[model samples]
Target: MGPDGVDKKILLNAFNMNSVGHICHGLWTHPRDQSADYARLDYWVKLAQTLERGKFDGLFLADVIGANDVYGASPDAALLQSVQVPINDPIVLISAMAYATRHLGFGVTANLTYERPYLLARRFSTLDHLTGGRIGWNIVTGYLDSAARAMGLTEQIRHDDRYDMADDYLDLVYKLWEGSWEDDAVVRDARNGRFTDPAKVHRIRHDGPFYQLDAIHLCEPSPQRTPVLYQAGGSPRGRAFAARHAECVFTNSLTVDLTRSIVADLRRRAVANGRAAEDIKIFSGVIVIVDRTEKAAQEKLREYQRYASPAAGLTHFCASIGVDLSRYGPDEPIEMEGTQAMVAALESITRYNPGRPWTVRRLLELMKLGARNTPIVGSPSQVADQLTAFVRETDVDGFNLMRAVTPESYEDFVDLVVPELQQRGAYKEDYAEGTLRDRLFAGRGGQLPSRHYGRRFRYGAGEWADEAVSRQAGRRGT
Candidate 1:
């Protein structure tokens, strides 16, 4: 039960990437893991079907544009470990998965830093339409310097400055998705031979330092004109950005106190921006290893650890912090400073855990599962109790379950944990009907809510702005 004594249904998203090695670095070597077949459509299709059967909320797809090359000042370690380098475009796989499942939402991460807002808006709209409004865009301003270099930049934009650029980019896309077309724009009158009423469609004009655009949306409005907006950032500036724009905020699973603080701050920031506290659903990334009994689950974890590599996890972490961990001795205390790469991640180790004095040895030991998050290993009842307490205390809406052994890890959660949570009334036994947005918000329509900052770009508001300009011009004529 929640603070209000009501059961808060836990939401789960199968957090994954279109690659062999995702969060759990070296687990791709597991015999039962089929993550290597990520290139095949059938693999994703089957995953989607399984998630639907388990009644998962969504499949959150993570993406990185370039290699993780900071460690040892090279990509060799990352390449050898298959650490997120042999990745594919996540957006292309969505339609097939959507076709296979009726209600699984796809939260795809696209770095807005390198993608043009105009084209990116159209692509999301196309997917939202194809998926019947079950599409979401995990808005990201990339942190990798390698990604910037690949996009023809010598270095990355300063950490906060990237968010600044993203702010403008979002405004331009909002104009396209929410303002360019009206609800009645499409007439589809075959007898009268008029397909659409052009007057209802308006041209959007935006001129900002980072992005400038003046065009009507290419396609007519999709079911959710703007796909469900998702953001992940825990820094002060990032929190501000998410508060203003994001409907769902992806976060890291740290200590309960730290997670609660972060969640509270996000909700407070949302309320400050004229949105309700409940508007933003928080999903923390976690790893789970479960089976029929506690002993079996512990044995499963032990078996999986044999193939895990702490060195690969360190390599991935090095790129995230923009520091080479290899320079530090095993027992030496590590000092971290601000970097263009994930500012929040660097702070997670140093700022959040004050006076803990993390060492290379401790960091490596934490990667027992070859991932940053430690696994929650237990039987169904034990895991369910822990998850319920987490939700009750942290006020987190749900979890983004990271894969330890691809299909095996996910299948375990669905069969084991889902039933236990359902029995406790902490999880949904069946999915709620409607678009992703509708299901998530329960009776709120499949569009941005009224209080959302994006809704200001809606049809009548845009038209009013144009009319006000014309009225001023008429007075000048008089």
Candidate 2:
């Protein structure tokens, strides 16, 4: 139970990656795990149906285009553990999942550092049309140097510079999505035999430092012209970027106070940028293991640990924070530099245990339960209570739920934990109407409201400011 009386609705998303071993590392080795079936379309379809049945908000998919070779200065360890290297494209699987469920939204992650803004925007628009607007884009600027090298770059760009590039990228996409087409452009008048009003379609001209475009948008405006933008970077630069662009922000924190502080800072930044504080939703990573009794839950946790892969965990950490953890001893403290991600990760650990210094061994132990996010091990009722308490204390909008094992971990959550949360009125009983954006901002419509910066591009009645100015000048007889 949350508090004495809490009526607020809690959003829930199933956090998964398009790979065999995601957050729980070596969990694919579990006999009951079906993560090996990630390549099969049926696995995704069945998962989508199950989530919709539980009234989950969306399925958040993480993707990576490069391998993790930062650890041990070689790719052997990462390859041996299957740590996000041999991953499939996340976008290709969404159509099949969308076909299986109508209400469930899909949040697919894509790294903007490597892809062109123009092409990426069209891909999302097509997906929005195909899924009837149940699509979201999880924006990531990438954190791995390996990804940069694989993309034909010498090395990764500086942290803040990537955000600057993303800012320009977003500006161009906004022009295409919101400015290029009028609301009534698609007349489809069969009697008049007019497919669209040619005069209503405007060409967008963007000549920025990073990107250049001088043409009309290729696709017509879909239900939600621009899909809901989700961001998952937690560093200082990352947070600043999210403040400006993210409709939903994903974070991982060990304490309620830390999470609350970060969320407050993001809201304040959003307000400073002229957007409403509530316009952006905050989702924290959470892992849960539940059983009939606390003893059983503990047993399950122990069983899962048996399959934990320390090598995979280290590989992920190395690539993320830009550190080579293999150079240090198991008990040696890591001294990393040149990256904000490293500083943030180190600070979080030090904050948790001020007296004990963080070492390679300590980090591996913590990641066994899915990175640094807190893990709840108990009966269904007990887990629900903890989740409610976490939400009440942190004021987070929802959770991006992680799993200790494949379909089994998610299955237990749906069967045991969802019922308990439903009984307590903490989780949704049923879904609301419209696209992913509509469901996320339920009372709000499918479109981005006027308050959002993206709305500045929406053409109104084929008479935008420029055209209005031209008409006024003509009337003045200049």
Candidate 3:
């Protein structure tokens, strides 16, 4: 809600990962923080119930395949401080969570680099089938060279090349998910001695530079044929890819002007790509610390900082942008090589920052909370004011709220800030009924709109996609 007394509901997702220490480098030591229980399903179950109780839009789970080991050109810093190293698979925990709570969407992050499109598509379809369409995919290309090396590659692929690969990968999956079978393909008839009609299921034939496939989709059509698409790309090439495929776009920037520019550019690109201006829901990552009073919130932040591990945070950053910062002195200027892994996050320290270019020393200091996103610490009213202002300034639909601690951080936001926003007419008092996509775009149907690239392949649409896919598949080498 604006201080001027206007009505607006801010979308909120509790940004988390399946690990002890996620974004906030070393706050696992907080007395009230039970992040150590990340390995247990009960922890996630409780978290899901809490988010649903608060009427949050989703529980966004972030994941990575490899360690953050680029700061000292070694894995010591990351492993020692437990900075996102012991991460588990986020997708595996969803069923239990979905079973525990209804209407709470799960936006799980999965890198496209390591998995095959056929297997990935089937798995997501299964999840959507099980969760009743309350799922979203945060499409990402692997960023860490450590991850690449661990997976038997000599090094990670070039920046733009990765997005190119992802473009091809998504097209194949789109066909598998959206083109393979009709909604009525399953015809259970005991008298006819048949479970499914084979004629209604089409085999998807894909041939491209990076991959080739001629196969039918393994799973039946779920509630949402394709899960809601979420992307967090900030590079021009990455943005182009996202504009083509994403339904929800996530961003993180240091300043309001830069974030606003990114949002405007994304919408303009979406429009250019034939999607409507409001097609994508752009969300900026934010850290909100709220309490009964401003001073209490400030003290809470200071206490959280007492246990922070800046080295772990910087090390994570180093691996992200492909630069080792441990050797550079305070006076040195950084040359950033931002990759597909949170391009906006990498830029916050170097290229796109509104203030002075951050030196290694300064960057280490600033990343104490592992905050690549903006952090707002204040009372409920004050936090609500800043939140409304941020939305107005950036034109982003909502936020992926990063945690300063574990469930305590979220509990405080719900207890203090949620009420204030509700009073200001800036938060939902109750969640709308439907699938995740339905909840996201209320009143709109659960399926992708006709304008979306993937929808061109729905069920029996052929020649239209046949030509378009040929051109897209040719882009494998472009």
Candidate 4:
């Protein structure tokens, strides 16, 4: 507790992607960085053990179905820089990691646009069952035209329409997860020779514009009927979708003021949608390098910078917001009308930091280690103070710590900063009981809460269940 005497706990999530070079472009070449071994099962297992030791809330694994070819209108730069290439499936790593650590949660990114609701529902249910309720889905809609082409489409769907499709997709999945199996559907009644009651199982019937499914959920009700819903959409339409469904939201903003505003807006939207003020926990992306003293931390950062690639960073940034920064002059400002992809993302950058607009050179500088997520290098105590103050001022629930190097970055934080944070009463000392949802939500059940739109689809629920898919379609005009 600080002067206010409020025990504010910060949720720490290890932000990583299943690739050689995830965020920090050339860090894979660092002498001690073993990121090249991402293909092996042991690498992930060791990572899981380490994070669980540090009392991290979860390990968020990012994925992309297709290559990042938007840079320079070709995939040459991306492939050469190893910028998230040779990426493997994130879901496959979860089971192995879960087997390695009992308490740590897994937030796996999955694009809802590619897979059907029924298929995706069963996969998550299986993961939830296997992880013993430690699984969470980071819902993402495909943004890359490369991904769209890979799926046999001419190009990606319109940005807002992607969210609209997700709106319908989630509605159908919710019905399958919530309405298909009654709470007590499975009964081990050997005396009566009944494994499950057929009457308790209901088929989820959905018929709408995008997809059609008329089948019961393939897997039984897992520990959590719906794995913890995590979403990372920052657009207006995205916020509305997240407000209605997401349990946790991943947020990225250039400044603290911007981040605070985004958090406030999301919470307000959630409340307006009939949820509680604290219903959605916003996790701001941050990069921290710490040591016993500020000088040591700064020295470490300098050493890491030697391996950072400014070129690759710029390449990745261009692909992210859909603007070819290489085409513009070094000092050219990125305007909204110019960007053809992730318009909402680019708008946030241009809108927030008016004094210094993001130019090609500036954007490249920001991506030296990773794009836009401001890195903080300081002594353990100083870093702790900064992080605590950030959360307090911004109303964010936690920080998603992006790794600068492999296990070393995480190891350093766990050894140094975590102790200081714990002493200051800003971080938890021990793992909490129950599912990931329960731990995050204090004592709330594993399933989505009563106010969540998903809960309305409870078995044989009101008129909404019958028309949920079509209802959302009509509302969105999709």
Please provide TM-scores, in order, for all candidate models, with all chains considered together.
0.97, 0.95, 0.94, 0.95
Worst 10 residues of 1 by lDDT: 1-10
lDDT of 1 by residue, 108-219 (tens): 9999999988999999999998999999999999888899999999998898999999989988898899998998899999999999999999888898998888899998
For model 1, what is the alpha-carbon lDDT of residue 99? 92
- Regions of candidate 3 where Cα sits further than 4 Å from its true position: 1-8, 337-344, 462-478
5-121: candidate 3 lDDT, tens digit per residue: 444568999999999888888888888889999999899999999888889999999988888888887888888888898889999999999999989999998888888898999
CA lDDT, every model vs. true structure: 0.90, 0.84, 0.85, 0.86
Clash count, one per candidate = 0, 0, 0, 0
User: Predictions ranked by lDDT, top down?
Assistant: 1, 4, 3, 2
Q: Model 2, which residues run further than 4 Å from truth?
A: 1-5, 340-343, 350-353, 461-478
Model 1: how far residue 168 lies from native, Å: 0.5
Worst 10 residues of 3 by lDDT: 1-10
Question: Listing every candidate in turn, what is its Cα RMSD in Å to the true structure after a full C-alpha superposition?
Answer: 1.6, 2.4, 4.0, 4.0
The model with the greater lDDT, 2 or 3, is 3
lDDT of 4 by residue, 1-478 (tens): 5642435699989999999877788888889999999999999999999999999999999888888887789999889989889899999899989988999999999999898678889999999999999999999997788898999999888888888888889888888888888888899899999999999898777887787888988778888889899998887888899999899999877778888888999999999999997889899988998888999999998898888888888777777788777788989887775543666677876865578787878877777674556688999888987888888889899988988888899999999989988887778899988999999998788778888878888775654455767778899999
- Top-scoring candidate (TM-score): 1
Q: How do the residues 185-287 of candidate 2 rate in per-residue lDDT, one tens digit apiece? A: 8899999999989898999888888989998988999999999999977777778888888999988877778899889989999999899898999999888
Q: Name the lDDT value of residue 334 in candidate 3.
A: 72
